[model samples]
Target: MPDTSRTQLKQILATRYAYLVRRLERITGSKEGATDALHETWLRLDKANVSTQVANADAYILGMASNVAIDQHRHERRHAHDDDVDVLLGVPDELADPERILTARRKIDSLKDVLRGLTPRRRAILLAARVDGQLNREIAERFGISLRLVESELSAAMKYCLQRMQEAGDPYTDSRSSGPRKF
Candidate 1:
């Protein structure tokens, strides 16, 4: 609970409720958990005996939501079900085959090697775009390069990775040959 009046908390929650839910979802890894945490947050805020005026209502509410999420995580950890025992009790295992797992590891290793072989700038651009989920424009701004250059580097890196994957006999490769296919 934050040191804010209930009225202010309610107002902040009303306006930015959706955003808070999305943030909580990112923290909790599921919509249901986020919803539950939000509900708990509302309840806690309603019962909080705070009289001090809050300078920033949004920050206060976000803090409360974060606390609720942490509590929910702790509760879940306490009651976590053992997967091994559950599997013995007729829970269907959608586990991957050992051969498939081995193939995946090999492909991952090959991709890592290919990425390692790239120029530093190209590798950084590709990682910023793909792994960090940065937009090309953002990468361009961050790297102090033109957007076109960023796109070119990213594309070249992707092509190299795809070519290496094809050479490694990647099952997901559309064309059977390692060479470029006629689209």
Candidate 2:
């Protein structure tokens, strides 16, 4: 027998175009989407290998149209639209600009200068408590000083750094200023 399935499908599509469009519109929820699906179905028919005969040509064509619509939807979802690309491009970069980077370097240099200006004992106490992550009690025992003296030295060092930073026109906010250092 001839490829009657393909021929029958083409005839049905040509004859029942409007009816199929209405049915597909209901299935796809939009006239434009339904029209596009039917057009895609027509294009796919030329490439399809219909070796076996179809018992129900209308259902077969409708099923093919539905598959085409689903495939179209999947394809569209895989690629970003122009508006999506524009929105992505409009997002601000997280990296600091050159001027911000220079300002940050200057602030760091100012902090280094402030650290260098501290007395050796005070600097050592501050570095031990803050940078070296030593406990105040441990620092006091290591330096042969009382815990009260350790706290006093750490506090003075912090206040001196804060004053120097403020005078340099870039104040550093201390988050732990609410209470004494715990660790």
Candidate 3:
């Protein structure tokens, strides 16, 4: 309400504004983000009824700027995804933490060793049964084999493949059963 108080606020803001902007820029590493952060800081300070409590106003502004930048960085980190070609080598997009990604990659590579030893026919049949969700009768009919042969072949193939995969140190192991269980 007083002219003198309004003049004092204006002077303090003008002197600290550039410093706030620069600190924000360093935190965000972008001019646009820094400008937005500065605007948000000014808005927050203006809305609060406690600006008079600020003894060292510049330090207070810088503190706000730092907190805003850290929050923004954390938000970005949460949504950041891997776009590298290495993702083609088999990385789990669900796991964003670097150690988890690296462990998933190692597991994939280890499984590949087992996949290399698998017969193409068995691999195709397994993929069709497991991934394509085909019935054993359907897979037998599609592959032109008897149902008995489908069961026998899948069992033998899975036994060999699972043994190899487990020995290769794959963290994710595929389960095997001798015959279908009625539950």
Most TM-score-accurate candidate:
1
1-183: candidate 1 lDDT, tens digit per residue: 454478678877877889888877877889888788778878888787766777887778778888888888898788867885577878655667788799889888888998998999999998987799888888999999998798788779888888887887777966444543111
Of candidate 2, the 10-residue stretch with the lowest lDDT total is: 171-180
User: How do all the candidates rank in terms of TM-score, highest first?
Assistant: 1, 2, 3
Residue-pair clashes per prediction, in order, are: 0, 0, 0
Candidates 1 and 2: which is better by TM-score? 1
> Measured by C-alpha RMSD in angstroms, how accurate is candidate 3?
17.9
- The segments of candidate 1 whose C-alpha lies over 4 angstroms from its true place after superposition are 1-4, 82-158, 167-169, 174-183
What are the lDDT scores of the predictions, listed in order? Answer: 0.80, 0.88, 0.70
Q: Candidate 2 residues 34-117, lDDT tens each? A: 999999998877777767788887788899999999998899888968998999999998777998899889888988999999
| TM-score for all models, in order of appearance | 0.55, 0.45, 0.42
Q: How far is candidate 2 from the true structure (C-alpha RMSD, Å)?
A: 19.8
Q: After superposition, how far is residue 180 of candidate 1 from its true place, in Å?
A: 22
lDDT of 3 by residue, 38-141 (tens): 66666655544553545666666667766766777788788756664457757656658889889888877876667667788887777777678888899899
What TM-score quantifies how close candidate 1 is to the native fold?
Answer: 0.55
Q: What lDDT score goes with residue 102 in model 1?
A: 92
